[model samples]
Target: MGLIVASGLCLALWVVLWCFHIAARDAAMISFSLFLVAAAVRTVGEQVRQSNSREG
Candidate 1:
């Protein structure tokens, strides 16, 4: 849920930057970094959930 929200915000930022023709490269880099972080968190969460389910 949190990841979804963060991703939305990043998308909005990217759009705003694109519309204004501002720091396009920086915006893209930030968005990419956020995506990577979200993916990592999601992967870790899934692994933890699976491990817990197996233990129980």
Candidate 2:
């Protein structure tokens, strides 16, 4: 459940950055990319984990 919420939060962050063009401090700009990567990795990892769990 927490992971699901985090995915939503990443989407909102992206909307703000790309759609609304929110100004973030120079260092914070890295956060947007990190969020995307984290979401993707988390989703892929979860899928792989679940598949492996079900295989046995």
Candidate 3:
């Protein structure tokens, strides 16, 4: 769920930047970076969740 939201937000940001006439390359790069961050966060969250479950 959080991952979905993060991805959506990144996509929205890209769209908004495009609407404002930002360069496509720049906007894509920014959004791609955001998506990578989101993916990393999601991976960390999953690892934490798994560790907690094991400890519990």
Backbone clash count for every predicted candidate, in the order shown: 0, 0, 0
Best by TM-score: 1
Tens-digit lDDT string for candidate 2 (1-56): 99999999999898888754545564477887899999999999999999999996
Better of 1 and 3 by TM-score: 1
For residues 1-56, could you state the per-residue lDDT of candidate 1 as single tens digits? 99999999999999997877767777998999999999999999999999999999
lDDT of residue 45 for candidate 1: 100
lDDT of 3 by residue, 1-55 (tens): 9999999999999999887775777789999999999999999999999999999
TM-score to true structure, per model: 0.60, 0.48, 0.59
Q: Which residue pairs clash within candidate 3? A: none
lDDT of each: 0.94, 0.85, 0.94
Candidate ordering by TM-score (highest first): 1, 3, 2
Which residue pairs collide, candidate 1? none
Which scores better on TM-score, 1 or 2?
1
Clashing pairs in 2: none
Q: How close to the true structure is residue 2 of candidate 2, measured as C-alpha lDDT?
A: 100
